[model samples]
Target chain A: MLIKSLAAEWLKMRKSYIWSILAALPAVSILIGTANYYANKSVLTNGWYSLWTQVSLFYGEFFLPVLIAICCAYLCRLEHFNKNWYQVMTAPVSRSAIFISKLAIAGIMMLIVQAFFLLLYFCAGKVLGLASPFPIETVGWMSRGLYASIAISAVQLALSIRIRSFAVPIGISICAAFIGLGMYVMKLGMFYPYSLLTIGIGALSQESLTIAENGLFLAMNSLFIVIVSAIAIRYLSKRDVVA
Target chain B: MNAIVSTHNLSKRYGDAYRVNEVNLEVHEGEVYGFLGPNGAGKSTTLKMLLGLVKPSSGKVVVFGKEFDKNRLSILRQTGSLIESPSYYGHLTGLENMRIMQRLHDVPDKNVCEALKIVRLENHKDKKAGLYSLGMKQRLGIAMALIAFPKLLILDEPTNGLDPAGIGEIRELIKSLPQRYGITVLLSSHLLSEIEQIATSVGIISDGKLLFQGSMEALQSKSQPRIAIKTVDNETAHVLLYRQGFHSVIEDDALIVKEMNDEQTAFANRMLVQAGIDVIRIEERRKSLERIFLELTGKEKSL
Candidate 1:
């Protein structure tokens, strides 16, 4: 079921002609980052955090989340726009499988967008001639960044599924992004939804995360994701589909 | 014979409005059952409940001897449906959509070609669904319903918006399913003519109630017979019938009476002739489903 669900979403993404943007975002973000790095070789000493903060904001904050929302929204747009939720909900497959399949797709798309961000961030660092900072835990940091982004995408998926209006979910995601900034500072980082992004990017900045603090954050955020997802999926499975 | 599908007092209420009010239905295996109703009469809502797409506010739907709520997946595996408008991803080819759904069903044999052929859409299977005409799209919807070789197929308004030829084609396709594939079909339509020609059993609904449910023969037996009379003075004949305490409607310049058996009609004919009324033609015609429906609903024509 998971594989088929993944395939279904993959088909939607590929057929919707999103591959161009999927391929373009990383390339374009990387080019911009590399050019910025060359223009400020003196600032290369400012370390990987500042350089990455500069690069990832373009890829991560603006391009990546929007791309994630578009893919997630588009995945649902197939059902919403064509009124195909009625078609899909009636299929022999269980409603849980259908909902989970969509969730999996959204998560996978988030994974892809995160990987692209990491790949471009790394490429930008190399082109800028910045000595690799904290080279030992690069994989760990990248994985944490990906994990946080995925959790955020889970929240986005739930929001997208519940609302019928396309722009509303997208608008909500943008607002969440801004809210994430404020949440990152309240020292209640784990409790705030957006703090997942900051914690993730902070971890990648070589900030030490005490296992207890990070674990609590992970647990709280994952719980938020699961709760929201359950509500959305339950609503979809139960409510009479108007379409 | 076991009923392939049965709904026991199945009702769905939307706040104050009851879309389906205690509808009791029984569709036996290998039979083509028709649900006939006008727009907003809840045909689609009832179907959605049967499919488990909409939760019933009350009552139960049993399919193949299993309760729908408990055995939803198991029951759904043996069933296929097209409710309301057919929906498919516009970007995907028809074949792709079927393949995706077939994969979800874990259906063996991958008889996508055979399914397409059943709807006569094999040649156009590779085209995007967006490109297909309405008739073609409806046919593809049927093809999807057949792809898994389900034991029962539920089609709602299968012929709506189709041309006469398209409607005829769908009728033939549905009729052939029982003999050719051994699949029981439950189809709903607002067109009484369509149901009259295709349905073996029919259930009529009005104002969210099941007005009647039985074999076509049973429905016909209950219907008021159509009385056709050809007279030289059509208006005078109509007035004379009214004056004689016989109510009749004007149809194609003829007076059409109802509820009169052969002997009563004969006596009326004798009286008309004796009254110097030139009756060129007098015959009892089969009551159309429409007239039966109107009469059953107690709807009267206004002056």
Candidate 2:
């Protein structure tokens, strides 16, 4: 049942123009990051690591959260508009399958966006004539960034599913991102959902995480994803759908 | 015949008021059951509850002899529905929308083409559903519901937004479903003529309450013909007829006698004349089905 549900979701996803969003956000972030790096190159001694901090700073803190919100909202936009929820709720599929399929699709789109961001980063480093060898830790940044993104996607998906307006969920995500930055400054980044992205990507700082710190990061994100997804599925199963 | 779907004391409330109150509905096999109501009469809400789209505030629904809550997916597999407005993705083509339904229904691909052809949308299958005209979009919704070839089909205002010709086509298609495909349909509409033309059984609802439920013949029987007598002295004629065992009431300057056949009409006129009432005219008036519907729904003044 889940496989069939996933197939249906894939069909809807493929026909939409969502790929353009996945490609555009990362490229724009790179442009802004490159400009800021050039302006401050005199003070920044580390070649590739300094660029990593600059690029990932904007990507993880603001653009990525907004991007995740957009993707999750788009997945649910079709159902919310024109009373399509009537059809989906009546379809011969389990509610769990429907919710999980949408989450899976959002996760897949995030993966694509992350990969493109890394590719743009590599190209930007080569273009800047960096003398130092490629920083291998940046790969860790990409992988951890993907993990945090999935948790954000789960929360955003729940918000999008409950609220009908397309812009409301995205607007809420922007506010959450700012709060996440404040939490990171207080050294409580490991607890908040939005702060996890900044810490995972080492956006504000490029120092490698200690082994215990890395374990805490993975465990916290997993907990958030599980809790948000559980609440979403329960709400869907119990509440009457508005069509 | 066995009932394909039945709801026991089904009710839905919003805040303090009831949207659908104690609506006990029974739809039999292989028959077109017309659910009749005026606007805001809770027809759509009732249908939504049956399809499990809206959870009822109280009561239970049984489909195919199984409880709906416990066997929702299994029951839904045998049921096809298009509730309220039609639902379709504006960006996807009509065929693609049907394909999504096909995958969820786990039916063969050929069924999608066949269902589209049934609704006469095969030619416009590639057009985006949002771009299609209102009538075309309605047809696409019906086609998607039919792709699964469900045994029980529920439609709320299916003929809405269709031109006369399109309405006729869909009406005939729905009317033929029982004999052609053994499909039992529960359709809701505000139009009395539509139900009269297509329904084998009728359920009328008004103000969140069901006023009547029975076969079409039973509903028509409520509109029996009557004899109207216009006499020079209607007041005396009414009393005389009543004394003579004729139940009559004076309305519109005439004595109206209900459920009177040809023989009774002649006898009543003759008796009135013999009593020196000086009958001026005798007329047979059959209450129209629309008037009965309006009267039962308490909207007689609107007529």
Candidate 3:
């Protein structure tokens, strides 16, 4: 059932010009990273994680989360148009299945977008004559960053589904990113959902954080994903499909 | 005959007001049922509840002898519907829209071509649905509804915003659906004439209440007969008709003479000739469905 719903949600997102936005992110990120690397080659070492931090800020912080929110919101908004919500609600599938299918697709897309960012970062590092360093930490940081994206996706997807407006949820997710910078400055990053991307990825790269720090960051993100997603699915199930 | 869909004391209330109040409805298998109501008359809301789209504040919907919410998947597998506007992924082709819907319903093979053929949209199957004309859009909508081979089909205002030809085509398509597929259909429309011509049975609603529900023949039988008379002598015709105890009102060049039987109208026609006035035409005017609707809903002030 989820497979079918995922296919349907994917079709809806693909038809709504989401692909162009997804494709554009890595292209732009790569271009900006390449230029920065070339101008600062003397000061830079052959560090994959360092290069990722430079490139993925453009891809991850600003583009990736907003893209996930847009996709989820657009998936629901398409139904909102012309009362297509009526059709979906009347279908034989369970409402929870419908919500999960959309959530899964958003998660999949988030992973794919992160993969593109990682691939571009690797290519940019090589082109700028940087050698690999702390390969294990680099891999660890990338995996944690990507996993944190899924957690972030849960919160954004819920926001988009509940709010019913594509612009508002995307706008809110972007604003949350900026607000996360303040939390990071205050050293309270582990408390907020938005700070998961930074803290999870930061712990892997900093190499100095205690095991306790890593556990706390990971736990906060996983808890946020579980609790917020449960609330969202429950909220969506109770509310009538109004489209 | 077993009812494919049934509702008992079904009510939907928004706060203190009931959108549909204590409504009991039944649609037997293989029948064409028409739901007639004006705007805000709760026709759409009733359909929504029956389809399990909206949760009723209080009521039980028994579909196919099983509770609707309990057996929703099994019951819905045999149901098709077009509600409000037919919306699709605007960028997707008409065929793609049907294909995706079929996928969602878990139908293995692609039925896009077949659905398009049913709606006479075969040639336009590859075109984006958004680019189709309004009538074409409606046909595509119907096609989508029927694609799953549902046993019970529901259509809400299916002919809205269509030209005369489009309306006729939809009416013909709806009329033939029951016999062709051996399926039951519950269609809602505000156009009385269209429903009168096509529906086997109708349920009329007004102000969140069911006014009447019965066969089309029964509704027609309750309507009064009217005769339209036209004369060149407009002033004399009014004075002479009024004086003869026939209450007649002028409609353009014709005077619609109400409250008079066929014999009385014939007698009035002879009196006009005897009075040296030429009767242009005197024909029996079939009582319109609109008239029946108005009378049933108590909108008519008098006969």
* Model 1 steric clash pairs: A180-A194
TM-scores of chain B alone in all candidate structures, in the order given: 0.84, 0.96, 0.79
Off by over 4 Å in 2: B275-278, B301-303
As for lDDT, the candidate ahead, 1 or 3, is 3
Query: TM-score, each model?
Result: 0.89, 0.97, 0.85
Worst 10 residues of 3 chain B by lDDT: B106-115
Model 3: per-residue Cα lDDT over A1-243, one tens digit each: 777777777676666677777778778977876677567766756566556656656655666667766767776777767667776777777777777787687777776776776676666767766655435555566677767777777787777667767799889988998787678778787788666676655532355457887788678878887887788778766775677
User: Best to worst by lDDT, what's the order?
Assistant: 2, 3, 1
Q: What is the per-residue lDDT of model 2 for residues A110-147, given as tens digits with 9 covering 90 to 100?
A: 88898899989999989998989998888898899999
Off by over 4 Å in 1: A31-41, A131-136, A203-205, B223-282, B297-303
lDDT of 3 by residue, B1-303 (tens): 888888998999999999999888888887899999888889999998888877889989998889987888888888899988776667788887887788778775546666777789999988988798888888888888888878899999999878998888888988888898787889998778878888999999887888998788888877667788999897898899889988888886898887687689889999999999999998777777787798777656743
Model 2: per-residue lDDT, tens digit, B1-303? 999999999999999999999999999999999999999999999999999988999999999999999999999999999988899999999999998999899999889988999999999999999999999999999998898889999999999999999999999999999998899999999999999999999999998999999999999998888889899999888888888789888899988998787887888889888888898888888899999999999987775
lDDT of 1 by residue, B1-303 (tens): 899999999999989999999999999988999999877888988998998888899999999989999998788878888888787878888988887777766675457888888888888889999888888888888888888889999999999778999889889989989988899999998878899989999999877899999999999887555789988888887787888788988888888988787887887788788888889998878866678877664443520
Q: Give RMSD (Å) of candidate 3 vs. truth.
A: 4.7
Docking class of 2: high
Question: What does DockQ give for each predicted structure?
Answer: 0.62, 0.86, 0.50
Q: After aligning candidate 3 to the native by TM-score, how far in Å is the CA of A178 from where it should be?
A: 2.2
Worst 10 residues of 2 chain A by lDDT: A44-53
Considering every candidate listed, which one attains the maximal TM-score? 2
Q: Positional deviation of B16 in candidate 1, in angstroms?
A: 1.7
